[model samples]
Target: MNPHTISDDKIQAAVALLQAGETVAFPTETVYGLGADASNPLAVQKIFEIKGRPIYHPLIVHIAAASQLSVWAQSIPDDAWRLAAAFWPGPLTLILQRSSQVPNEVTGGQDTVGLRVPDHPVATSLLRAFGGGIAAPSANRFGQVSPTTAQHVHDKLGVMVGMILDGGPCHIGVESTIVSLVHGDAVLLRPGRLSVEAIEDTLNKKILLTQPISTKVRASGMLNSHYAPATPIEIQPADELWIRAHQLANLGYKVAVLNLSDHKKCASSAAITRFQMPLQADDYGRELYASLHRIDHANFDRILAEALPATPEWVAINDRVRRAAQGTTNETRILVRTENR
Candidate 1:
């Protein structure tokens, strides 16, 4: 095992590295988070620098306990407590008014901050041992596929991450479901494995899913064109996807196909490769980014994907796929469009 991967066993060392204001990539219930001391603005700044993230983008502060929320954020309402009580140690983040201790840099110069308590034990142990909040975003380059494994972090960032705490793969491979309580109304900022219905059921109220996202309340994953890969990707229905892949292959372009094919469909020829995504949404979500990371490293010149089902369970997956496929222009378009269905 790598030294970085052993952070789960040597948690004290991981805590020590964080206390020294160095960045570490650690696993959470969602994707692996690139963490630094939240209170240390300089350390937090390094996270943005290393990831090539924009200064205006806010970072989520991960805590070990729900009680610690008050330290970073202020004016927590009853709805926040109710949601936290129900979803803490899970894949949900709450945006609230920031405390003076939370620097403007953390909130992208806004008066609010995103806070989460990850459900991974290694992340909890690190927070508890360090005795403070860890400011983290996804542990990959800005606007790229988020990393789910420690190896993904190391492969993408190399030594940019001082250490990586490998807690194996994340259970939920997408980012956390972010909701804003800063306005005293339930507004869904971003979707994740935790569905909107689950959050609404926990709060017993109907929540708004999308909004104009004013400067005062900008949250994570608000950007329209993010989470993309270097490969030019086009998405279509499975039948249409295969037709596109075959056409691209005939044009002398190597292509990769991703669909919900339980059995392998295309043989791996010089110009064509194939992969199967599970039909179930949860299983598909878990494999989404990691699979993308693999496809990204391959020699494929173009990628053709099958669009997921347009159902409530697939909302988060749909949002991510749309964003990831947003900026592929040169390779030709088939059914790639981000406009709402």
Candidate 2:
């Protein structure tokens, strides 16, 4: 089966499963989403049980088109419409006040709901056939690396999903940019495949970089530790990555390096492994999760990554990487440096 093509029968099968209140994992431009009927509280609860996701963290409701927006969300702001018109059918998610039609299960008991029209043939086909909202998050266990391919979904979710729609590898390979319009201002709740500049360009106004404290809304991917791999991860400066990786390897610990520099410059040693990363931000985003998924299963003692630049273009990548590396400490670095001295 082609990654870009999904048979109508397959799509209809997924739609049927969703309509029956069974979870269906389908491809989106960003990542595969574990989808459930948004109107069914019991069905939505399955998503939480399947992913082990906390009930407090809301799921983004995937719709077939922008016209269905009012069906799930109310008090739709003008900026939400503008952003939807500009970035919908793509990787931008708009957060708006929940409509009475929306169940609290989908919104995590919050008054606001996050919604997006994903730009993938399989996802769009299933949504159109179902003709309703499907609340979905990354089709992986909570706090783990998100799945980017059907195989990743199957491996991570396995028999838990009623069906898997193999649309191919995710094109964008990251979550959508979540912008909250519930607060009357375009607040960026999460950085994702879509850039902040693009949203501002469409709205012709600067979006708030940080969500205000008083009006804070709980949205997906807002946690400090998320998208993490099982192996502990540490990030080091490009200037120091080699040294630190070498130190850990010399310390008799197996280490893997997510080298962001030129591959040839970072030589792998007997105890050290290196995976070269893409230089451009877009390419990097597409490979980040898949690479982490690969690295996570390779049985390394620790994963060390070269730090990315803190530029506007790399904001989304940095955000994901930083969150993924949360709870990682510098104890290894300290041990290595102290031993070398």
Candidate 3:
């Protein structure tokens, strides 16, 4: 299949499945999404069951155009319109007050819904053809690495999805930047390729960080232990990367080192494999998940990733890496090394 073209016939078939209360895995600029008719409660439930995602966690509804925002959300704020005009048909998501027309299932029973118009031809084509909102989340298992390619979706979801629309590799290679307008002030719920600075400059006002303790709205990707790979990842500081890799390798564990810095000093052993990652933030974000998918399948016992920079430009990358390493611990890493040995 040519990744560049999505035939009209394919769009119609996907639309049929969705209208009949079924799910389809389709690509977006950020990632492949497991989408279902946003208006169909039963079909939305299937997404939760298939991905083992908690029902209380919300999903983002994809619309064909910015004009359709009113269909899913009500009491839309002026800031919503401003941001949409700037970032719609791209990688930004706006959370607004839900409309009566929106199914409770789509919003996780909350009064707010997450909406975005993906900047991808296949997603837009499918959305325009479907004629309504499509509630979607990253097309992978809950708390696992997101699928960036059609084959990744098939490998993770298989026949569970009624149809898989392959739109090639996601260009952004991360989820959408999610900002909430339902509150009195704009709050960033999740970070993606779209930087927070960009959003603030567009709104001309400071966006608040998410206050999990006080915030009632539950947005997707809010959990600490998300986007994890099957192989537990340990984020090592740049200075200690080689030391940690050698430590694990000496203990007889197969360690995959995700290196984004110091490319000239390539290190490898029978138990250690090194992968050179993109140096720039944009390129790194685009390649992050695809690299995770490859390393996850390569029979590695653990992943030791070099810590990324702490600057604003690297915020999204840092967030994802932090979450991916959230569940990993020193004890667990040592245990895996010893067990493998």
lDDT of candidates 1 onward, in order: 0.85, 0.87, 0.89
**What lDDT tens digits, residue by residue, belong to model 3 across residues 171-269?**
989888999888778998888888888999998989987654676678999898889999889877776788888888888889999897885665777
Encode model 2's per-residue lDDT on 1-341: one tens digit a residue: 46468888888888888888999999999999999999999999999999999888899999999999988888898898999898889999889999998888888889999999999988888998999999999999998888999999998889999998888889888888999998888999899978899999999999998889999999999898888887778877777888888778888988988888785766887899888889999999999989888877778888887888777878888878777888455453311122111
Superposed model 1: Cα runs more than 4 Å off: 1-9, 212-216, 261-268, 334-340
Candidate 1 lDDT at 207 equals 92
lDDT leaderboard ranking: 3, 2, 1
Model 3 off-target regions past 4 Å? 1-4, 333-341
Q: What TM-score does candidate 3 get on C-alpha atoms?
A: 0.95
Q: Which portions of model 2 miss their true places by more than 4 Å?
A: 1-4, 263-265, 327-341
Which one is best on lDDT?
A: 3
Estimate TM-scores for all models: 0.93, 0.95, 0.95
